[model samples]
Target: MKLQGVHHVAYRCRDAKETVEFYQKHLDMDFQLAIAENEVPSTGEPDPYMHIFLDAGNGNVLAFFELPSQPQMGRDTNTPEWVQHIAFKLGSMEELLAAKERLVDAGIEVLGPTNHTIFKSIYFFDPNGHRIELAANTDEPGMLQELKRVGPEMLEEWSRTKKAPKTAAWIHGEGEFPGYQG
Candidate 1:
């Protein structure tokens, strides 16, 4: 079965109202709709929850659930903060920088304009302690094509040694990538 696209992605929240407000104020996401029920429709369990939906632009939806009856929310302690995050694409470098400024103005501590070869990004935390990243693309025309060209070789090397292959190291401009390391 071929999949079309994501209808929505849902995560747990501490408070539905606060989650909605945070996304609205910070990310400019419109509150689309909210679903409240005393029982889960899919599981048939008697657990009350408030499910909220936000517009993530271009027909994409981000959702959250606030389960008041459950224990307080906590993240996986084993996972590093950067490993699990929600990343959003901003229109341009200017827009990404502006967002970082605005977030700092709102008393949020943000990190980076970190360059990832093909994009530049900033990182911050939302009210729920979820790491959020906003990135702007900066790749040259054939950048993606170049990466795709090396995909097979990279995967083959990785499969054999379980180590990061150097095929795409040009992005990092190190080791044999034809660039100064400093």
Candidate 2:
């Protein structure tokens, strides 16, 4: 079967109302709809929940579920906090910097306009303690193509050695790879 695109991405939230308001105010996401059910539709279990959907621009949707019956929400203790985050893309670096300024003005502690070679991003936490990243593309022509070319080789090397391969070290401004013209 061929997949078209993502329908939506769902996560757990502490309070549905607070989540809705936060997304609306900070991120300018429109509250598209909400679903409330007293029982699981797939299963027969009686677990009431409030599911909220927000329009995340360009036909993308971000959703959250508030399950009051469950215990307090907690993150995975094993994974590093920076590893798991929801990233949204902006059109330009100016927009990214503006967003950081707006978030800082609102008294939110935001980290970075950090450069990732291909893009720049800023990080902040929502009221629910979910890390959010707003990034803007800054890739040069052929950069992605070069990375794609070396991806399989890098993966194979990583699988064997369990360490980062130097095939794409140029991404971090290291010495260029052989046969790289970009």
Note the Cα lDDT for every prediction shown: 0.89, 0.92
- Count of residue pairs whose backbone atoms collide, per candidate: 0, 0
Error of 2 at 55 (Å): 0.5
lDDT of 1 by residue, 133-172 (tens): 9999998667777777778889999999999988778788
Residue 37 of model 2 has an lDDT of 98
Candidate 1 stretches greater than 4 Å from native: 175-182
Tell me the lDDT of model 2 at 123. Answer: 100
Best by TM-score: 2
Tens-digit per-residue lDDT, 42-108, candidate 2: 9979999999999999999999999999999999999999998999999999999999999999999
Against the true structure, whose lDDT is highest?
2
In candidate 2, stretches whose alpha carbon ends up further than 4 angstroms from where it belongs are 176-182
| lDDT for residue 140 in candidate 1, whole number 0-100 | 69
